[model samples]
Target: MAQKTVLFKHLEQPEIHRLDVYRDAGGYGALRTAVNDLAPAEVTQMVKDSGLRGRGGAGFPTGMKWSFLPKEYDTSYLVCNADESEPGAFKDRELMERNPHQLIEGCLLAAYAIRARHAFIYVRGEYLAIKELLDAAIEQARQAGLVGERIFGKDWGCEVSVYRGAGAYICGEESAMLDSLEGFRGFPRLRPPFPAVRGLYGKPTVVNNVETLANVPHIVANGAEWFKSTGTEKSPGTKICSISGPVNRPGNYELEMGTPFRYLLEDCAGGMAGGKSLKAYIPGGASAPMLPGDCQDVGIDFESYPAAGSTMGSASFILFPEDCCIVFAQLRISEFFSHESCGKCTPCREGSRWLRQMVERIEEGGGREEDLPILLDVTDNMVGKCFCALGDFATSNIVASIRHFRHEYEQHIRERRCPFRPHPAAEPLLQIAGVA
Candidate 1:
């Protein structure tokens, strides 16, 4: 574990969230350097040179995203996506709650680099506590002249605002988040006129995830080469892997990119819980296809998992025990996507419903042999057919479940019940003495 701590090192220090404590610890020095010495282009180029990618699942290049703004734009915005709504992903929330100024300073550095005066942190409404923590951090920064006007007594200044959204899973999508921030219903907007070109009040905007922005200050303070020295060439710096499910030490572990999943499972998480052997695991969140547990040697980076036919999205690993029912597990996922569908696209709105119904029926022992192909066909139609990835996300579980655990599904149908999971106890029966 040669991974040097970029985000987690100082988290335990008391009052680390305070602007004063953070500044004394040499925080915001990157923002100061950018404001005092570096030009906007230089800062942007530095991030570009560092090879920072979005940590919010997509793995898109951060520098290129900032560079997308037109050369001359009067108005632009920088949105820090703090809506950590994905199940098994709580990295952003933890970052903001513990070391808030780091995220704030990162946002300001990015705002300066992009030449955007206004930055907004669109946090999930459920994270009211985190929102307030950020709010206080912003005010503290403002009072100290780090935000508001003339940051660091320089001509350039960036103001950061914390905006909360109704808890919509769809809002985690950048476009939908834009719509929600703009006071519209949280629905995903169509692309082609991508947010970088025309976004947030019809102006150029750059939306970076909480963890992505939090990395900015570190990259600025430490040279790109220094940052690059930690992780793989493509994925530089450590990644906070949010480990969940039945692991003995189920929590967040910051590991260098390219660290094998086996290390995380055995060394960090202390292996599976209750002495249960691994059955299957979601390499990413629910949106990623589940990989059989035997693939533990797969590296936790942008490339490795996909090479193994699964995504390393957000690195939200959810493991399953051998005794777990694959059919029932997928049923819950289907139900969630069905309920959270934004209803913006027909394939997603309708396809998700159909998948959930069929999966529910199959899990409940009402499925026919023919239902499997029908389910696959439904997911086939749903994948990449929706306005957003939500539609495509809904398909990963079912498709991967059958691909890897088809035997389990077959058992469910053959036995007319979930073999791994115990069924409800039979109703108690009593007979009257006279009747007997």
Candidate 2:
């Protein structure tokens, strides 16, 4: 967060997020260069050399994902997973809303690289303004002949359309986004056909997160070596991290990969609010396991997080100051996953309801001491038993809190009340059976 490096480079520019300013800064030149000069295969190889991975929750390599598409497929597509519904994660929304043309240019380059004829920008329904912004940008690109038929006046042409999601968290999942974009109920499909081989209308598709695609224009424009110079050897370039919760400066801060977590919190975020001591931090979005306050010194990158027993998901760093209860935080997180369960499998659908109910009972002063083991049991049953990641997504919060702060849950049960009351809005909610 210190110094606000990569992803935020344009945020401070006067109208820098606008297309005109972006072009002046050498924006869509990447697309023109790629389409005009480089072969699609060569472009993909450049991305591979740059070591760009998915900025989405999953940290899959971008070029590797694109390579998964079989060569024979005629109509491949790219769906920008702009459905930034992960709780405490809003980086993608910022990218699409502010630097939309960058994403469009990246999309065009990616479509050309993957030989995708048509692409779709699946914007989150809640971001109607961003949806409008991107739509206008796409139109502008079309008018300028940067998109649509005969892009740059060559035989190869690709067009893109913006598809609005109906505000479902499950749609953020790549396969589910395909289902939703195709006008289905947004349930996750089984993997194996994976989406590279079978996706969006039953053809090959390359789904990249908005931030991931945003980097493509930069990568294509500046060469792979230039992109490689910014961050760690394995994880190059900067990450847009959003710091909230009791921070003096609670906003998105872009920093080079592998930056220390301490620097991100204490330096970039201007330290905690009111000079309070840090308690715990959710390194990734809510779905990732929480990290104890002792682990705050770990580096913020793809490699360091798993070693620290967390993920660098979407580079979201939600800080919790001291005096905040982990039980309260865990309950809030559990409720989100439980509510967002796509109901594709019983383990998540039923297990999330039970977890929420058990946590609520403990929080509300009515739970038994024996319920602690039962909560673990519920999560244990659901962890790998569900259809999609949604089930594991629901269980991670419970397991993480219990693993790190079982004593906190016991304290709530023994005291029969929450210990800290910072905000009236923080009033704990009791679980109603069958509500989840």
Tens digits of per-residue lDDT, candidate 2, 297-320, equal: 777789999898888888777766
Overall lDDT per candidate, in order of appearance: 0.86, 0.82
lDDT of each residue in 1-436, candidate 1, tens digit only: 5334679877568688988889989998998888889999999999999989899998999999999898999999999998877767777878898899999999999999989999999999899999888898899889999899888788888889999999888999999999999999999888879999999999999999989999999999998888888888888888999887767787778899999999999998999877988888887888899999899898889989889999999998877777667787787778778888999999999999999999888888888999999999998898887779999999998999999999888888888887755622110000100000
The per-prediction tally of clashing pairs is: 0, 2
Against the hidden reference, what TM-scores do the models get? 0.95, 0.95
Clashing pairs in 2: 1-268, 2-268
